[model samples]
Target: MFEKLSYLQLQQYWWFLVGTLAALFVFMTFVQGGQTLLRELGRSETQRDLLVNALGRKWELGFTSLVMFGGALFAAFPLFYSVSFGGAYFVWMAILFCFIIQAVAYEYRKKPDNFLGQRTYEIFLFINGSLGIFLVGAALATLFSGGHFVVNEMHLSRWTNPLYGLEALANPFNIAFGLMLFFLSRLLASLFFINEIDDEAIYARARKSLLRCTLMFLAAFAYVAYAIATMKGYGYDPATGAVFAKEGKYLQNLLAMPAVAGMLLAGVLGLLAGVAMTLWGGSRRGIWPAGIGVVLVVLALFLTLGYNDTAFYPSLSDPQSSLTIQNSSGSRYTLVAMSYVSLMVPFVLGYIAFVWRAMSAKRLTVEEVENDPHHY
Candidate 1:
């Protein structure tokens, strides 16, 4: 069926798949968010262990989804992957280090006589949750704000700064975007705890933290939204393939793509409604709506960037060096082969859903965790 589609169509299809993976990964980051909640919700050793075990159950899933997201993007758009991964070494390296330590923490946190104590490993999880998520958000913001990279005629890319991707930290808008995702992750983690844990004290503390996180999430979102709404965006001419900065380009994309605009609006409202249901309506299932909202919002944002002739990875060092789906995609033969493999995605998702249901069949309890021989 994909044989009939044009090269551009195949690129769009792969980008859609990549974007979906990314959106799901964002939702899966509740694991990272929950990592940050180990201390706040868990007041004692057992309590902390309960929280750790709870997050541990799903950390591998989050990590797996993240790897898949990156892999899909790399397969679909090798240029974007090479440019960002090569040029943004510092940011990506720090994120990679955070994930490595996270793996170490979960594996050895409870091991007896491990040179570093459990608390040290716990700190590792915290860094992965906070700094890691923040940097991921900042890295994503570069898609909209553009990066300081130039691509030669041979298509090799180079970073324009000594700090490499660490320079993203210098942008206030990037920082706000990072903070937004960081707090959003924490908020989602709280909602997840409210849904997953059976302890009353943990639930109360989770709710308490949720309220503050919600406020912080909204504040950071406000700043990022304002910046996006006000910022000039990169666009390319379909005929000539030259990139240019247009005033309010992102806003124009939203206006031009009404369906995406609707998704964005629905996503915002759904996210807020989920918080209301938990905080006011006494609903434990807020994670469902909130998680779905995160996927929709992120998916819509990604669509806005990759669709409508916009530059998904704009270049500030050289305007024409911007990477779009069209310019950065792999050859048609590669995309077609990948497209066939992508058909198995639905079956994989079905397996994940089955496992998720089996795992969460009952709320996690301290007693259960204490008795389980395999508890993290």
Candidate 2:
């Protein structure tokens, strides 16, 4: 059935798959967000343990989805993998380190007589929660904002800035997006806590955090939206396969394609609505609506970056090095093969859903953490 479609169809399919996985990963980062706020949310040792255990129950899902997201992007679009991964090594390394520490911190934080004290491990978790999500979001922002790398004639990439991946900080717009992710993660964390943690103190604090983070999220998001919509964008000449700068390209893309525009608007509204409902209604189940809203918004953002012949990853050092979905994707045969494997994605998602349901079937309380034999 898939063989009948053209190669371009396969590439688009893979892009969509990658986008979907990315959306899922973003939603899962709520675990990281919640971890970052452990100190603020928990006043007592028992309460802290409760928060850690609640977050611990699902941190692996975020990590696994992140790894899978990278792998899928590598298989589907080798050039982006090579260019971004190669050029942005510093930022990538930092994110990797953060995640590694997260896994270790969770495993040994509660272990008896661990070399590092529990406080130290908890700090590590906070680092992962804040810096990990922020840096990753910034790195992704480079997809639309371009980066400091030049691709040689042979397609070898060279970093133009001495700061390496950290150069992304120089772009205010990128930082804006990064801040948006950080705050959004925190917001989601609050919603999750409201649903998962039953302690009144923690629940009230989570609500407050959600409200504050939502404000920050909106501020950063508005900045990014304004910048992206008005800024000059990298456009590819599909006929020549050459990339060049075009003014208001993103806005044009939104205007030219009604479906994409509709998705963008819907995603934004969904995200806002979710946050509002959680904040105003004192809803315990805000996580569901907010989580789904994040997925939609992120998916729409990714589609805007990749579709419409835009350079998803533009090279600031050399214009010719810019990469579009058409040029950076793997060979048609490889894409087709991967497309077949993608069929199992539903099963994987189903398994994750089942695990999530079983885990969250009962709300987590301090008493449960103290009494449960399987406490993390």
Candidate 3:
């Protein structure tokens, strides 16, 4: 079935797949968000244990999804994988270190022979949760705001600036998106805690914090959206396929693609519904709506960045060097073969859902954690 499609069609299809994976990954970051809130929500050891165990059930899902997203990107768009990962080694290394520490923290936090002690590992987990998600979001922001990198004739990319990807900090738009993701993840975490952990103090604190974080999230999201809507965007010539800067390019893309606009609207409404229900409706299941919303919103955002003759990865030093889905994707044979393999993704997701349901058969409580023989 994949044999008949053109190379451009395959590239677009893979972008859709990548966008979906990224959206799911963002939603899963709620595990990190909950980690960041461990102390803020927990008043005692029992409450903390409850929170940790609740988050532990889903932490691996986030990590696994991240790996899959990267893997899929590497297979479908090797040039983007090489350019971004090869050039932004420092930032990627830091992000990887954060996740590695999180893995260690989870495994050893309750182990008897753990050398670092529980508190130290918990601290490391908190750091990993906060910084890791924020940095990843910031890195994605570079797709629009541009990054400092150059590609040679052999398509090998090098970091043009000494700071590597850290130079992205200089872009306010990128920072805005980063902060937005941080607060959004935190908000989702709070919602998840309210549903998963059965603690009055934690629920109340998370409820209050969710309200505060949601407001901040909206503010940051608005700023980034506004900037993207009005700012200059990279456009490619249909004849020469050469990239060029065009004012209000993103705005045009949105107008040109009504389906993306509908998705964005739906995502926004879903987010608002989740937040409002969590705050006012005495609902413990706000995570469901909000989590879905995160996926939809993030997917739409990625689509906007890559589709409609836009440059998904732009170059600051040379605008012409920007990479689009067409320029960066792999050969048609590779994309077709990978597309066939992609059919297994739904089965994986189904298995994950089954595991999630089994683990969350009942809400987490202090008594359960204390009385249970096996605890996180």
Candidate 4:
């Protein structure tokens, strides 16, 4: 069944898979967001412990999802993996360091003979939650805002900027996108706490923080929306397949693909509905819808960047060198063979669900953390 499709169809299918995995990774960032809330939402030592243990139950999922997303890109779109990871080694190294410290913090924080102390580990988690997530957002922002890399006829790429990927931080739009993602993670984390902790104190604090998180998220969302609507976007001639810049190209893409536009609108509404359900309707399952909303919104944005003959990775230094799905994807045989493997994705997702349900079968509490021998 997978062998008969044209090369473009296989490319689209694999790109869709990549986008789906990316969305899941973004949704799982709630764990990172919750890490930042350890001190802010937890008033006492016991409360902090509760937050830690609850988040600890799931942090691996987020980290693992991120790794899977990267791996998928590496396999399905090796050129992008090479160009971005190779050219932007500094930023990737920083992100890798942050996550490494996070794993260390969780493992060593509760160990009896740890010399660094718990506070140091907590700080490490905060850095991973904040700076690590921010850098990811800034890096992704280059998809829409464009990067400073150039590719030659031989398909080799180089970062024209000396700072490598760190230069993305210099772009105001990237900064705003990073901030937006950071706050969204926190917002999702708060909702997760409200639903899963079953402690009134933590619930109250988490609920209270939602207002500020919503406001901050909305402010950043507004800026990003405006920027996307107005910025000159990278595109290619569908007829000629030549990359170039065009004003309001994102808007054009959205309009050209109404289904994507619908997804974006539905995603926005789902997010708003989740917040409303928590704040006014008094629901505990806001995170479910909110998480789904994050996935859809992110997926829609990714589609807008990649589809409609648009360049998913634009090159500001050399416009024609931009990376598009047509140019950067794996070979036809590679994609067809991998498409068969992609069928296993459903079972993988089901297994993830099973493990998640098993791990979270019982709501976390101080008593549970106190008694559990393996609590983080």
Q: Which stretches of candidate 3 lie over 4 Å from their true place?
A: none
Q: How does each model score on TM-score?
A: 0.99, 0.97, 0.98, 0.98
For model 1, the superposed segments whose C-alpha errors exceed 4 Å read: none
Q: Weakest 10 consecutive residues, lDDT, candidate 3?
A: 150-159
Predictions ranked by TM-score, top down? 1, 4, 3, 2
Count clashing residue pairs in model 3: 0
Local accuracy of candidate 1 as per-residue lDDT tens digits, 84-117: 9999999999999989999999999988899999
What TM-score does model 2 achieve against the real structure? 0.97
lDDT of candidate 2 over 1-376, digit per residue (tens): 6788787778778888899999999999999899889888998899889999999899999999999999999999988898888878899999999999999998888888999999999999999999999999999899888988887767677888887889898889889988989998999898889898888999888889988999888889889989998998899988898888999988888887788788777777777777787789767888887788788778887888888888888888887888888888988889878888999999999999999999999999878898987677
Query: Model 3's lDDT to the true fold?
Result: 0.89
Candidate 3 per-residue lDDT, tens place, 217-236, comes to: 99999899899889998999
Clashes of each: 0, 0, 0, 0
TM-score of 3: 0.98
RMSD of 1: 0.8
List clashing residue pairs in candidate 1: none
Number of the candidate with higher lDDT, 1 or 2: 1
What digit string (tens of lDDT, one per residue) describes model 4 on residues 180-199? Answer: 99999999999999888978
